[model samples]
Target: MTDENARHAEKMKKIKAARDRMMETKTEEKGLIMVHTGPGKGKSSSGFGMIMRCIAHGMPSAVVQFIKGNWDTGEKTFLRERFADEVRFFVSGEGFTWEVQDREKDIAAAKRGWEIAKEQILDPEIAFVLLDEINIALRYDYLDIDEVVEFLLYQKPRMTHVCLTGRNAKPELIEAADLVTEYTLVKHPFRDGVKAQKGVEF
Candidate 1:
């Protein structure tokens, strides 16, 4: 028993030393362009989680919802009401492609949304901006990817973090991003004839 305990203690000590050494090389403290893309859910949820963190730290946050109709989502309503002064929220999409059924209008909405999004992102006071479903817009070619990436490169503030969340993220946006996370769908109740619930799916 004594020998086993000593081995465990030595292993933990080595692990801690290695971890501390690796941490020493990480000296960056600036905003990041994070992308969350996949077929599964939780892309926007994770982006909203970042907004929650920003709000907790007393930093302002903005949300530009693209390719998603303005639903009465709990998070949206809560943030709009609770942090009215600290957050700016906008929904620029009428609905999904199947529902919208018009290419010209879709393009127009995307252009309008991107315009609003740029306004929020260029504001240095807002520490976090969630470009919800922006990837979908790019996938449909509703907005110019090169223009978006250029704006992100030259206009973003040093202390402002931007989160782009959706499926089918463009290659250019992913390459320009500082962090990328892909969520794989393993199982979902909707496949089993279950509808999207109020709190969970919405």
Candidate 2:
């Protein structure tokens, strides 16, 4: 081989060795508590991606939508149609707070949503639980952060992974999560007077 080819192969050999060493160190397996929060979008989208992944892996999964109403979403439709048995989907919101316009009603919806989440999370058969838009509920005090954290600590199945998604996540919840992702807002079409598109926003 030429000198350039030989150097490229040597660099790749070292890279492979480093990657192997890193992979060798990740041997422990435990249920993960993930928080996806911030002002930007894609928080629920990312959690839905994981739900799809769980379905692909034949793991039972569930969704409890806290702040999103019974709007027809593409992900929900697809998951319910394709893998209905492995996925249990629930929508427990009347809409956004401004749209709902009733504090007590919103609180009731949040409580109902959380009750469903508690059921799915405690079910050992359900390996993944997506608490969709729950962060917004916590931010609005519709749900108690301390209570949620306590349940996650003591009630959730040991091997069940839980994902919370929405903006303004509570610091206590963030501290309790094993993984946290904050979606920073750089640019959004809504700021430019463009409405949410069919497949992109919903």
TM-scores for the candidates? 0.94, 0.93
lDDT of 1 by residue, 101-170 (tens): 8999999998999999988988878888999998888998999999999999888887788999999999
Q: What is the per-residue lDDT of model 2 for residues 52-105, given as tens digits with 9 covering 90 to 100?
A: 899889999999988777578888788778878989989999777888789999
The stretch of ten residues in a row with the least summed lDDT in candidate 1 is 67-76
Which pairs clash in the backbone of model 2?
A: none
Q: State the lDDT at 136 in candidate 1.
A: 84
TM-score of 1: 0.94
Q: Which residue ranges in model 2 land beyond 4 Å of their true spot? A: 1-5
* lDDT (C-alpha, whole model) for all candidates: 0.89, 0.91
